[model samples]
Target chain A: MRLDQIRPGHVFLLVLILGATLWYLLDTLDTSRRLTNTILVVPLAILVFAAGAFELIREILRARADPTTLEQRDVDEDQDSDQTPVDMLRGVVLLGFTGLLVFFYPRLGFDLAVFLFIFASLVMLEPRGYLAKAAFAAIFTLIVLGGARIILPYPMPTLIL
Target chain B: MLDTTAFSGALALLGSDINIWLVIIPGLMIGLVAGSIAGVSNTMAMAICLPLTLYMDFLPAIMFLTAIFTGGGFGGAVTSILMGIPGTTSSVATTFDGYPMARKGLHNEALGVALMASVVGVLIGYVILLLVVAPLGAWVIRLGPAEMLLIALWGMSMIAALGGNSLARGLIAGAFGLLLGTVGMNTAGHIRGTADIPFLLDGIPLIPAMMGMFAASQLFTLIGSGYLIKDKTARRADYGKVLSGFFQVLRYPVFQLRGTLIGVFVGAIPGVGSSVGNLIAYAQAKRTDRDSESYGKGNPKGVMAAESANSSSEGGSMVTMLALGLPGGGGTAMLLAAFAMHNVTGGPSFIDQNMDIVYTIILGNFAQAVLLLFVGLGFLAIAGNIVKVPITWLIPSVMVLALIGAFAVTGDQAGPITLFFFAGLGWLMKRYDYPVAACVVGLLLGRMVESELIRTWQISGGGELEFFLNRPVALVFAALLVLSLLQPAITNYLRARRARQQD
Candidate 1:
């Protein structure tokens, strides 16, 4: 089980969990020396860190045993066997679009941000459906915006309806 | 248990109100719509309509609210089946098998199975509620924090059973979720993981986080797919298939009964409600079934188990609300508010003096359950068409709806931010072959686990072993938890021994 055999993404996730748990446990201790405050957090943090390390070791062993086994193990229901780099890029782009939509929700407003996000997403996902995409983007934005306005008690920040 | 005079009086009260009958359909529709949408909870719907009930008579108001409760039970299953998004936390387990069925082009059957199970579950829940409300309420009140801790632990065990292929990954995900759940304010007034965010004070909002994990993440993964159902010819929604799915529930009578019983009992416990009931039922179904391997991959029994338990939980929750004036969850809390509005308090006196009213509410829910079958069928007819939409269009549209839904849930930018963050996390977990469901369950139960664990600790005077020794109920639950945890291993060992004998 060598470090080179480890997938960076898997290791990062494991480390993230272990690090977050450790930080949370320490933070709870910082907040209070009371046993109640740290009781569950301390034990839970230890369990997660322990599990994360064990998983990392197992992944390394499995990778060392059969390199392809690690790759096969990583492929889940979300990914197809023939998924290409382009598909991965598309997923990342779609995720980026979502992130930007949330980031600009207060700035650009719900209506405008959502409309632009939908329009851009549709165009990106279906490159040949400009007319349909625009129409859908408009209609969906209107329906969602209108429905939210009616249903939600709180007023949403909006540039225009 | 039957009081003849009260029974007659209940029948008379139900007959006296024509508006009660009129509000049932609308209430059901509101619930169905609210429950189908990812962010709008049935409690929210009922709260929105609470003012409308102020104008109605007491009986009508109660009926209207209960109708919403009954309808929302099945409504959440709609999106859960067609998409992986659970409209409410109660419907989370439903998505395990329901979404897979939709992916496999069995959306109609899944919808049918969920609808029928919900209807029957409500009927069974109310029947048991009617017979045992007084006794059940009394017993539920006796359960302490130690018992609750055990129950939460019981729910947490589902993470182990659901940890698909890797128990280590599952434990990590669940523990991480538990940590996230405890973020914000501890019951002891200590805040741990908020990192200075004001919204973190309430802990991470559960619904928005859930939408991100299950819906947004799943949508991200479906980016390159053409449609939800990959098989082009199998994409159409068939009413006949839905009816077949409806009748198919009849085949799993034992499973349905088990789920309903679990729902009622678990739901009767205040604060636990249908969310945990559905998970426990799904896990039990998976544990007991011969073809358990097919679960989480589109098993109809999984859908049936989840829907039945969650739906039946309404009755279980009502036991606490009506008999103890305690709200089991948010939905029942709204019902309690409605009770206060009507100038009617629930508890021993309310039941003792107004047994007829109690019977009327129970009888009214029975009618609502039966009517749900017909009304839910129409709703499913429309929602089941989601399979026909292309993935390109559906993905962006649903994502936008989910983001807005998250906003609605949180009433601020925090909701969308949490949704996005959890979405990325969920995608990574899903991509790495980790069971996102385990993590979701952890997040859902985390705060409760912490609070209960804290209470149990305080009650025990710093975790003395003598405290558990004194608590018979907690000890029983503890034993059950141990058994539940070991069930998988025991089953595997038995199967292996049987194979050796045959060989």
Candidate 2:
């Protein structure tokens, strides 16, 4: 069967969501011993899973009624084009850069690494003109350092340069 | 004598201090630019610019900040007219007719109308600020937490009133936001959603959360749509039509006056700010106008009504902040925070203690407004040019600015990281037919509503329903909420009756 017709995507999403919810629920319960508070994550996870289950069921019914409807359409539309895996992967990569910066800013230092991260991201987001990209990266780095690094309450990361 | 001396002294100070004007000029320009860009917000502009204020003395600092405030409020209309997208929540009302005007090739005329209305609004709001700051402050200080709670609920109810078409979904989104607010630690010393993340212990970063809900979400959705925003190179309009459009405002004084009143009243309410005021004023103007059917179709009146009230609300909001030590909007809240940093209290006593300084700030509102008028018109011309810049250059630059602004706020990469994640989440929510604006409204009002409900419940010894029922103000607000929730159904029935009569 085609993946969408069998509702594999829905099933996969639901199960993954359920697993994450269950993990969060268990983690909260485990942590609650030290803190006396309402079990918020428990309710949240339940709701999310329940919503996912409902969605999966609805998708299956639609698939059974008209299997052809499950087929992915042409990606010509402006709205659908961005939802493609390429764009998602771009976001994933950008977010990964962000995660790396967040976790290791103190070690590698802020000024050098952040500029590098931003430069890398810009090139990835728009790859063609190296000169234009470099100009953008340099201007962006200066503005952030000038505006934010100068005025913020917290101390800026120590610059090696 | 007090008035003349205050005015003269403030004027003299303005004349002597060229440095203040320099700061004001740049601040106003930034405000205009921020307002013109659809995804860039005035608050974000101000927040990014706020660190610049720390070094300057209080007067110059407040002057620069207020200039940003005034300029940003007026700037949002530029984008709304040029593009269908509104730069700020206040500009949402502008889009009803402003975009339609642009589509009809009266973009310059619509912008001229927006600029004039914003000027009038600033004047009206400031006049009220001049006259009522002391008395209003005195009266509001006497209000307990119970009263504060009622006011907050009133603000939240506007979501149902303004949500248009999908009211239930909006209400649900708002409820969800309220629920999320309760996730963190309460004033009762109980932790709810700590989840081993110590960073969230002080509660979800309010500004970051707002940035996520509105700014990030919008960017993500825009990125996802992948529709390249093609730049148009239309010739600039004749100066005569634009000038006459400016005077067209006076012909519709009722709209201008009504919107101004709504803006001022709503802005005066502590915690409700100009964002909500703009919506309420625009809705009221639409509901009352003779040409209600022409709304959302490029009517100059719609732009006038929204821009006027949106601008006017700032003055009233400032009155609440100065007089009552209560913030009427986010920027004012940040100002209050800044004041707290300096150990200065706001209210009647504050004015009595530092009347000269308070008057300076109040007078600065007038200066900022006048400065904004010149700045807005000039930028409306310039932004028209900037919008023509290649998307390849423009989009990356905006993304970079947004990234830098986000980082500047926290000085940690967490801000930018949060920015992208929220943007993606925002896109998903939009894709899935979830109401992003309602989710934002929910997030915005969540803490106020939760804190109030909690406070009210505590007062009633854990009696939530009884507390709501017993208080006269609360009961009235609850009744209003019910009425607002039922308005869509009520309007639908009325529409049907009108249709039958026509047939």
Candidate 3:
């Protein structure tokens, strides 16, 4: 079977790999290897994976008898079947916009970059009223920048200079 | 352990230190405002406030941090009650009772209950801190990675409670979180999934990823959910009735003590925080309520149980961190880092050596509770006005703040990048009707769990599960895990059978 086909097996494989990786890393640390930290991780990982596997197998089993499971059918029927391309496109756009903001943040300066990112994200969400959008953006920017200056010491490097 | 001198000194610092108070007050106010807004969280508020603490003295910095935490906890209930949308995960339980009460036009009463319960809960937790910090500290210190791993898994089991009816989907989301947690370099001295990116070396910061998962995803949902109704009709409850509400909460001694105890214990566990405290307390209250059917409606008892319990968790969580030097929750982890940066370490030794500081921190939580009662009540109206801020503007503002916080935490764009990654995943979990809390818990505990499991395997000579069965304590815990997983399904099955029989 393909890896995804045997869902629980895939989970076990992942857990095993993750467990091995952590063990290797912890060995390299110079600190006291507290017995609890060293010895208890294996069972815990095994238990989590086992629980997850059981849940997955049960779900698959239930799905197998889809016609017989009237309750399951009823519940599934209530679930939204109409996932729009617009939502998918919107997700892509959100991901892209976030990437662009991070990319330009160093060059554009903290204030400008943050402002643009906020403004773009808001506009994309399509909040009502232009005035509401502008006012919120300005107010939020002021509070954050002003709060940082007065209360926190995190220097916002400016590109203006 | 009861460092009276330190407690007094901390109080003196609060009263006399003009500069620290200045930082504390504003930070508290900002955190309150941020936490009250739908889609904003205490974690997000603290992350935003973190950069401000960088320049201050350690005491003042710590004071400001805890103040935000205290204020944010109360602030979350405001939106939860008024708009039927939880301001933070902690308030998710609050909405069950608080919103219903609000709908009945007893908004003031609900607010009063929440504020009073929060204060009482904090006091109970502080008392525990004063009495048993050292003993508890020593005990927790003895807990190895093996035990910590079990505890973290216990915390993750909260996903079952949070996941609602779909345990499978919830575990899947949790599994996804575990996968994301492994994206950085592993404990094995080798990078696993960094894809050769240098910034991924340090791993993702908890705060930024959480801000994205909780805040950004909420913004997405808000867009889809559409506009919230304005609650201008809100009437102030008789301010005098605040005492009456407190009395009402006290009358139920069992509820108060049980919820507070739950809060303290849950709070002591690393990775579990107020959100779980509220959830567990609410569930417990429901089970214990004589009129259990009245729960999830306008039950003031539910409000008291959840709000008080959540507030208490802060006190319990802080004590464990100070005594053990092991961070029990996100807030304490931040506190731990702050101490390390200042060349200070907290643990049993710290309590013994610097009794004054430890006492002062404990006193601060008590003082914070008292302060929250008065300030939260007095400014409810002004704070509630935050909801009037249009969603269009509010969304952008929050995005900017979350973006800044994310970037600051990582000192690079990767922080914000992780936000998008998690936010997308968060949105999917929501869309699929899965539990977001499970994902958060899983992500938080993934590393600790993975490392401990690996270590345990090595110790067991890389073999047989029989070793877990050998240790009596581990075996008992293992048995409990099985029972916990099965209990829900069995209960539901029995309930269904009963209904059929009745028919």
Candidate 4:
């Protein structure tokens, strides 16, 4: 199989599964060599690892025999087949924004962090509706914050209420 | 099986208390709102409200709690149908077909169908509980570890059906989930994959993980879409369509009955409740239906099957809690706490002595189920407007809510962090054609399967084969599992043979 036919995402996921399975299996065995501890973990992990290996090998072989199959596999009708580089970038940006939101949530306070995330995400997703987006973001944040304060038993950190 | 004395006493007790009837609507409302929220669970809602019940009489308190239980069952479906996110674990399978229907501009119908099925499921469940709560409770207690393990295996079998064109990818995803599920400490007091994180001691927080996988992952994939439904005209919520959808469930009585029965039996098992019931019901529906290929794509029957099973599970679970004092799941656990608060103990003795109260509870639930029809209709009218929102706005808003919910669930950063990690993992799995649902199921059943296997082993003294042979119930389940596994192949062979004969 040509290297070009191998989808890096597919390979990466398979390897991650295999690596995690092996690591977990080894960890369980290391913790205790007892039959009870390892009974479910050992067999299941080995099976997963083998399955991951088989899938990887099968994909490679399929790629060699039929390149079109690999291409066809990636094309889902529900998932936009025409996903441009710009759309890809948007997805990445959204993902990064979410990660940042989570990272800053406790630090910035739930209310402020959520407001900023929503505002920024709206601005990024909808180009012409900045004022509307900001208003919606602020209002939405306040309402949810108010509800959270009332509903949640424990207090959350907040910059402003 | 009807206790004549209890029946008359129950009727008198219910008639004497106007307060009992008064709490039902409010309890259902609280439950609906709680169940629809991404992070808030029915147990959490009930737990928060448990103290309020302390001031009330016993019947009213139990009725209020049960009202919440009933409302929450259907409430979870609102989010599951409207958004890809399941409001609670019970509604996971609802999202499989319900969300697809929403995407296809059938949100109203989907919601309507879910509501009707849930109502009918509850009614049927209560009817069964009324008739067989005594014997059924006795039977459910007889289920040993072997049976539980087989049930877990049966749930795991769903991974094959969900694999979506690639069995290997599906199994790999499921196994990966199983590994993730077993990440925390084992039953033997050994920690395997915690990486020294203190919170991992209990295992990955399930609700946060679920929100990340199903909701966040789907949101990420919808980055380019303008709206949830492309057809603007179809996006409007119509009462007519909803009523039509409600009536539509009547056409699939057999499927509804099957799902309801599965829900009751599965939900009766402690620790295994509506979540597994819905999956089992959905799997059976998919396996048996002629249009099985349309299941995940947006078959209303799929929604009916899932809703009926999950809703009916409340009844099934009630049987255990009422008869054996064993909580079937978290909601019932809260109910048990309420029972304690009232100085009421549930068991065979409780059933024998307080048969009137048991009948009262069951009869009260019947009223709650019927009242839910009208109350839920109003709730749906408001909830159904979700389709009109622009995808761009909805995406960020939902993601934020989900993160907040995750935070609420874990009471710390762990929830949001787990959600973020799983979201990334889920997106990758989705992109690579792996079924995230299978993985979710695996994660859910993983710990249970392991614990049960260990128990089975201990009981058998390491002679599992011999022990399994002795378990008639286990043997029956084993046979059923084999049949379920081979059903597709058998059906295909029969079809092929018929085609050849016709030729």
Question: Which candidate has the highest DockQ of all?
Answer: 1
lDDT (10s digit) by residue, model 4, range B1-503: 99999999999999998999999999999999989999887788898999999999999999999899888888889888888998678898999999999989999999999999999999999999999999999999999989999998888777766877777888788888887888888776778899899999999999899999997567877777888898999888899999999988998899999999999999999888888889988998899887889989999999999999999999999999988989899999999999999899988999999999999999999999999999999998888888888888999999988988888898889999999988888887887778899899888878888888888888988855888888898999999989977887799899999999999
Per-residue accuracy of model 3 over A44-160 as CA lDDT, tens digit each: 344546655675565465445544443654357335533355644555576677777767777787666766667676777674566766666666667776665453335666553
DockQ sort, best first: 1, 4, 2, 3
In model 2 chain B, which range of ten residues has the least summed lDDT? Answer: B224-233
User: How do the residues B334-379 of candidate 2 rate in per-residue lDDT, one tens digit apiece?
Assistant: 6776576566788768866666677677777777778776777677
| Model 1 agreement with the true structure over B1-503: per-residue lDDT tens digits | 87779989999988887998999999999999999998988999998999999999988998999999888989999988888999799999999999999888888899999999999999999999989889998999999999998888889877876888877888888888888999999888898899999999999999989999997557777877788888888787788999999899999999999999999999999989999999999998888788989999999999999999999999999999988999999999999999999898989888889989899999999999999999998887787778888888898889888888898888899999999999888987877777899899999999999999999899899899998999898888899878866777798899999999999
* Residue ranges of candidate 3 with Cα displaced over 4 Å: A1-99, A113-139, A149-161, B1-69, B72-114, B188-190, B224-226, B230-256, B269-310, B317-365, B460-503
TM-score of candidate 1 relative to the true fold: 0.95
Error of 3 at B29 (Å): 4.5
lDDT of 4 by residue, A18-59 (tens): 888888888888899898888888878877878788988877
How high is the lDDT of residue B102 in model 3? 67
Any idea what lDDT model 3 has? 0.65
Q: Give the clashing pairs for model 2.
A: B96-B296, B97-B298, B137-B323, B216-B423, B273-B328
Q: Is the docking of candidate 2 incorrect, acceptable, medium or high quality?
A: incorrect
Q: What is the C-alpha lDDT of each candidate?
A: 0.88, 0.64, 0.65, 0.88
- Backbone clash pairs in model 3 (N, Cα, C under 3 Å; residues 3+ apart or in different chains), count: 15
Error of 2 at B129 (Å): 2.7
Off by over 4 Å in 1: A1-6, A58-82, B487-503
